[model samples]
Target: MKKLDVTYSANIGSYLGVPIILEDNTMFGTLCAIDPSPHKFDKKDLELMQTLANFIANAIELGQAYEIILAEEQRVKKELELAKKVQTSVLSEPVQLEKINIQAYYQSSESLSGDMYSWFEISPNKFGVILIDVMGHGVSAALISMSIRSLLKGLITSISEPIEVIKELNHHIFSLFNSTHQSTYATAVYMVIDTELKTIEYVNAGHPSGLLFLDQKTMKRMDEGSIILGIFPNLKVDKQLIHYNEPSTIMLYTDGLTELINPVINDAIHTVENIIIGEPDNLQLIEEIKKEFVNGKTLKDDICLITVNVE
Candidate 1:
């Protein structure tokens, strides 16, 4: 009572206060009660006051934590948007050449996709087409994919051959992200089309089988896929080479499309083959796929497809 250091304590004959501390041992503020008349506080009264302070501290902490979480959510949303933009930029448009008309369709279950398809004009008469699906989805797979995307043009141009391109890809995965978890890898289909040679040379690394329409009635399943990329130091890859007997439409896709159509991969492939056989033209096939899968259904994974027409 005699202490002049107490600010605004002149009218208050009694005062009780306790500091509020968070669970992390950080001090927040003071909890206090003041009265004009002096009153003695018992152990129970002090305990109750402390208990109230603890409740307030917990409430404040909860509010703070909620705010932090909201801020983090907004930050992640913005980052994913930016990443989607960057990812979209790298994806090449369909290569509409004189002898070949290549078209691609891509959709992500999330803002960012692990599925990607692109083609590079390796030479005047030849172009390289690739479609890949990383092991899982989201940020980690996306990062790995972008890293691989950066290397695609050079690798496809210099290597040229499908077998060597995939082997070098495996080597890169092993060398670059060997630090990642064991399951970090991607299934891919790399193809080199020579319009002049009239041959399609391709390598499938644990991806879905590509569909090739030989004629209106006949279809060939390109299922000679080896193990996935990012596995094994020494890899043996046999490139499959096929000469188009006539004007043919070749479809390369990730597993996401098949997985959506039917749980069984082979059955889904069969369904897709039937659909493509019904409408073999590039635009018609893409339209059919949209009507069946992308019309109203919500996808569970990334879907990417590439179509090449040899005329």
Candidate 2:
């Protein structure tokens, strides 16, 4: 075990003339053969011992490095799974509501997403729908969207007005980010549809303007909300009242749908017109809208579409 210079071989058992390297990087004294006749060991045997020591050192280093990498990978995967659960929970669980027929879609650019949709029946005839897009994508944005969703569900229950809901949600979100200095915000559209009265009430807050498909050849963009949410406090949202005279299709969506850089928004509007132009049916129009967005092409951001069919 001693790491002395080329000296004191006899004291450390050099009977066989075989040299050994200790695990602690120190060379052990040699052990020579026990034959009566004098014999000398070759240089090749010493070289082999040196090579074996190097291999052991390398194996230990590699094993430690591999474990470190695997640990990191598992940590990331667990975080991602948690985020997915949160995102999915933010959506309507059953995906079906009474009186108001809903069709919506969401696509994310990564494992975690920034887009979210929340909807519930306010009454037997009235339904509230909210679609939102946080500033960025992935875990941070998804968590923020989830918070907004929970806050809205609580806020909307007491308040049926879209404008008031946005104003309150904005203040809550702004206060949250101010404490953290995150500077995050969301673009949203809140719509309240009354089937009995046959009207659509909306409060837009810096969202992509929506389009109302009146007939096969006509469609009008509805984009009259105030500033984006989470930016200012007590801001007023523009309210629009859409009167549905007959059984027609109404489209409300996130910016990802129209602005995917595919120029499909215009075509999408035209497509809606083609299907429901002359006389639109509720069931038939929803099928066409789903076929347009869900098939053939993929969306870059979260794409959500909610359609109301007036009976």
Candidate 3:
């Protein structure tokens, strides 16, 4: 203090003080006591003063740490809220086309999700559909999914071929997320449905095999495709074509739905086929499947389901 200068020392007869220092050796302030008359402080007096100073330093440090934690928590909460809003906006609603009905259901975990799904009508009876699941959760994964989302309509409409569209998407993903130390990737399935031709050309890139239901039974399993996107410099894509003369439904989903029933995706596809068998209405089928999913177990990850019902 300015009052503790040499000029003022003559007025203070006796004084003792200890600097309040934190664990990081940052000096906070001084703990001091002064007497008007001359006096001598003993060892006990000095020890007591030192203890009080230490206590004050610890309290101040703890209070500061608590405030910092609170601030960080608030910042993260706001960011997640913003991310969730952006995520919901990008996710498209279920659409009904000229020859096919497209239905989708999504469930988010505690935080943000990487699961994304959408379908765009290329023409009256032709549509391009896609479902993607990035590797992880939270802001990073959600951002990657959203970035891919922005490219969906353009890629689907322009390319119009499953293999070419997925290959292009893989190139984009690889270019965006490849780092020297780490890389991010996502599993995806892209389909071009031509109701006039009664054909569905699809490519599954390191994703769960899709289920195709016809005549109340599982007819085809979509297992063709290559590795996930964003990992390697080059990606190999295999497109599979299926013909459905009669009315049929195709189920495309992320890994979250499989995690509850079967860790194996093919097995999960078979299990869900049972639910879609009796329900002919695409909308009712979607609701029934959603009910089946939440019946007993809690969802561990984000679940996204897209069903294409060709009429």
Please give, for residues 200-298, the per-residue lDDT of candidate 1 as tens digits.
998889888999997455798887857988877668898899887578999998888888899998889999998888888887798899899777889
Q: Please report how far candidate 3 places residue 74 from its true position, in Å.
A: 1.3
Best by lDDT: 1
Question: Model 2: runs farther than 4 Å from truth?
Answer: 1-63, 93-99, 215-217, 261-300
Task: Evaluate residue 44 in candidate 3 and report its C-alpha lDDT on the 0 to 100 scale.
Answer: 99
> How far off is residue 261 in model 3, in Å?
2.0
Could you tell which candidate, 1 or 3, scores higher by TM-score? 1
| CA lDDT, candidate 2, residue 282 | 47
lDDT of model 3, residue 129: 92
Candidate with top TM-score is 1
Model 1, position 293: C-alpha lDDT score = 79
lDDT of 3 by residue, 159-273 (tens): 7888888888888888785655678999998888888988888999999888788634556778788888888878878888887778888888888888876887667777877
Candidate 1's error at 125, in angstroms? 2.5
